[model samples]
Every structure is written in structure tokens, then in C-alpha cells.
Target: MQTSSTLTPPAIRHDEWALSDVHGQYSDANSHADLYRFLMRWIDVSTHLNIGYSRFGQRHLTNANFTRLIDRIARPMLELYDDSVHRHDRRLLDIGSGRGGAAIHAHQSYGLEVLGIDITPYNVERANANARRRGVWPAVSFAEGDAQDLPIPEESRALVWSIESPAHFPDKKKFLHEVYRVLKPGGVFAFSDLLAVPTRVRQWPEFYKEFLRVWDVPYLETMETYSEALWELGFDLRKTEIVTKNNIDIYTGYARRYLTYFRIPGFYKWYTGRVRRRWGANLDNVREHLRHSYNALSRGTIDYGLFWAIKR
Candidate 1:
């Protein structure tokens, strides 16, 4: 993957929380509770995929499927460190650890003591439940906490990880600061997420508006701004990989999969029930926006980024 020097455009922000609507409309009908559950499930799959877990399954990583992802993420970083000099009883922290798959995988497979945290109670609870269900309880625990003010002590964590969650944070700088604070001296942090770029330089405002309506998340920062913020917060750059070209293919494949998965007799009815009830008036526009995302991705106008850094 190639890293680009050109700065991406600033993320779009909306006064209204459009993401809540997207969650409400897309999940099953008549229940905001159900919407919450659906969001957690989606995050689990997305985070795993974002971090290189290719297989899609709800069950815990039982077969070789789970360990492959565990090794993929940790083995490279571990190799980069001095084996004889590094801490053996290293403490790892995972921010926004959806479903605890990554944490449990790390603990059981790599023998790393881990703590997974998420703001969503549903995710936290489900993750903890899954940990126990997999018999990795106590070793891998989930905590309810905000990423902005991490509960971990300063200079305590050997490694920190976040996948696809920071984009939702309203303040990226503060969130970066928290990650920096919790990481031990010389600790490594790995992060990956979608990058926002202006549709056209002069049409930023219009593109920003389109951005929120499409992703339902606010305040996604660009790769340039993100790197600058990390440096400002005292992190030494390790490696930056631009996954945009590949992510375009990945997301395009996802959209196709979504279409096939949701088009099933019972599944389509399950998905569009609330969408029709709540946004019946704007259904066409919503469909149009979804099409634009798929088309834009296929054309490579948008992309995802992955990077690693060390606390300086």
C-alpha cells in the first residue's frame, strides 16, 4: 500500500445527529433497543474486518480462523520490538473493543493480558458475555467507558488498539491525548479507520452534508490532520499504509454482500420495516445516497487508512 503526502479534506459535521436516525431506520422495526443490538453486531464484524479478520461469523474464534487474525495483528508488532528487552507481562488495552473478539483472541492465543473497553453498554455487556461463554472470562474483560477519558492509568499500557471507533468521536484531539496518556513509555498503538476527503475542493460544504447523511457519523478527520494530531500529542510515526485502493474493493464487495444478504425474503422485510415506517417520505433519497457510496467506492473517490505509532 502507498502512503499519500497530499492532505485529505476536513471531516463534515452536522448539528443534528443523523447517525441515530440511520441506526433507527435500518435496524428492525418498533424498537430502538433492537437498533442498539444491531449496531453492536455490525461493529463487531466491521472492527474484525478492519483489523484483518476476514472470516465472518458470530461465534467466538474457535477454529484456526480466530488465531490467524490474532497473529496477524500482534506478531508484526512483537517482532518490531527487542525480544529480550521488552516486558513479558505486557498489559494491552483495546479501545472500542466490539464483542471482545480481538481481546480474547490476543489473551488466549498470544498470552497477552488484555482489557477491552467500549462506550456502548450493549457492546460492553455482549463482549463480556462472550468472553465468559468462550471460557476466556476474567482473562479478557470488557469495561464500560468513554474513549475520550480512558480509565486506564497513565503510562500503564504496553499496547493500545482501536478499529473503526475513533471516527465517531466528536473530538479527535482529546481522544488521541487519552490514548497517548494510557500507553506506557515506548508503547505501540495501532489504529485504522475511514478517511474523509472533499468530493471536490470548491464543493466542500455540499460534500460535507452528503458525508453525514451517508455514514451517519460526525467529525471524521482526514489522514493529514490525523497524523498532525498524533505528532502534536507526542507520538512517533512508525508506519502508515494507505488501504484506500483495496478498501474500495472491500467496501464494494460489502455493499454487494449487503444487497444479497438483505434481499432474502425474510431479511429484506426485517431491514426495511422501520426504514419505511420512519423515513417513508425520504426513502428514495436514502436509496440514492446508498447508491452514491457504492459508486464512489468503486471509483476510488473515498478510502480507508491504517497506521501504527509509538509514544515518544
Candidate 2:
């Protein structure tokens, strides 16, 4: 806990307390885990947590319709799967799998038996409940576990993937090393991550700061950094791609919608009461947060990277 002496003013400062929660979002002491427990408690993971995939000219998809986009994150990576080698069985592991949507999708689509692990306990419970509701409970299981110190045994998983979740890991190198540790020989490892360009980030620090503050990211590593780490760990890199435009702009339109919503008189007061009851913090500043992140992505300060590699 921070001493009161180091605290920011509790006034109606969006970037401080009232509207913007620029404090305790992420740091050496405060992690993304704390941010989820404190600030993002009210968020509905099914709809809000996953980034929308609009690459195929689709937009505004909801409910079951959104599953296609969700599968996009897993499909490209799982395409490496070979039925010839494992004709009767295919098992996979998902790191930081949120709410079990993609895990269930993997099972339904590719006949993969998936084990998803998440750092958040509530997310694990919700993911298990979702698996039961989807009738995939035993086939698609979720457990509470940290990424940097995965609970799974070494040389156990034939395939593993994570989707858009590693940005929040305080120790990116440690997380990647752990990923290497868990894979079986010839196992394929795939993941998509939000990345940073160090030079661009250093050019405009505040935009990056706001992006981290809103999203609860401790720090970021570059595309090159991750690729080099994978090579150093003896993984043969199969593919690495970055499409920042597709990853980020999906939310800019929503940010504009919420910006208008936030501008409405009395909306702040109404939201304040709702958040107090709902364990929420920072919806009022969601627009600013998204806007800054989009700006970073759009301006080349950050990147969205998809990687596929195999252990030899």
C-alpha cells in the first residue's frame, strides 16, 4: 500500500482520481492483477475484454456472432496442428485464457481438448462456469495460475497459446521463458501480444503512460525482443506478424461514442454511483484511455504482434 504522503489528490481529476485513475494502474509494486481486482471488477469479460477483429470487414458483432472474431486469434496459430501425428487426440494449453470463450471455440472447431490458465480467480471461476454452460466443462477446463510461473509441468503440452494478454505481465522475459519451459519437444507455441517500439515510446511518454494506466499494463517488450528471446530459447520461429491498424482502430469508434456519452451533463454523477455499487473505477475516463492507446498504435509508438514458433 502506498503511504498517504505519496498519494495524488482525491479531487475531481480524471487523470488523478475523479475521472482519470492515473495512480496505481501499474508499477513495480502494483501489478495488472491488482488493477483487475480493484479497477476492472465491473467489466464483463465476454463482451468487453477481448479486442474485436474487424479484418474481414465485419463490425459491431454481438453475442454469438462475435465468436468468429474470437476464433481468429486462435485459428492462425492452431493451423499448425497436424492430425496425422495425433490422429485421435489433440490437447492444447491456453495461457491467460480469459473467460473460456476461445478455449471452448478451440474444442468445438479443432477438436482440441484445452486447459486454460488465468491469474485471476474470478476469471477462472467464470471460465469454468462458462465451460459448463457451453457443455464443454471436462473437455475445456480452466484453472487459476500465473503466467510467469505456470502451474503446468515441463514437457507436457503439445500446443500452447495466449491471446492479447501478455502486455500486462510485468516480466515479459520471464513469461516467455516459462512458455518455453512448458512445451514438449516439437510442440508449437503461439501467442498474440501488444508490443512497444522503444524509440517511439520515448518520443511521447505521456500517451504511453495513459495507455498503461488505463489498461493496467506494467510494461511492454518489442517484436524484436520477443523474437530474439524465442530464438535464444532454441525455438524455431515459424511466423511473426504485426498489424497494428486492425488491432486498435476497432475501439476508436467506441471511444468516440463514449466520449460523447461522458460529455453529457450528469453522466459522471450517475456513473459514480453505479461504480461505487458495482466495484468499478475509470469508466468515466475510458474514452481518454482508449484514445491514447489508439493514438500510440496509430502513430507507430506501439505494435500488435502475432507469433508462431515450434520447439525443436
Candidate that scores best on TM-score: 2
Off by over 4 Å in 1: 1-11, 18-72, 81-85, 199-211, 254-292, 299-301
State candidate 2's TM-score: 0.77
Candidate 2 lDDT trough over 10 residues, lowest sum: 5-14
lDDT of each: 0.63, 0.67
lDDT of 1 by residue, 69-132 (tens): 4564566566544342445746678897876778887887777777998876666777788888
Query: Candidate 1 has which clashing residue pairs, if any?
Result: none
Model 2 off-target regions past 4 Å? 1-44, 61-66, 83-88, 264-288, 291-298
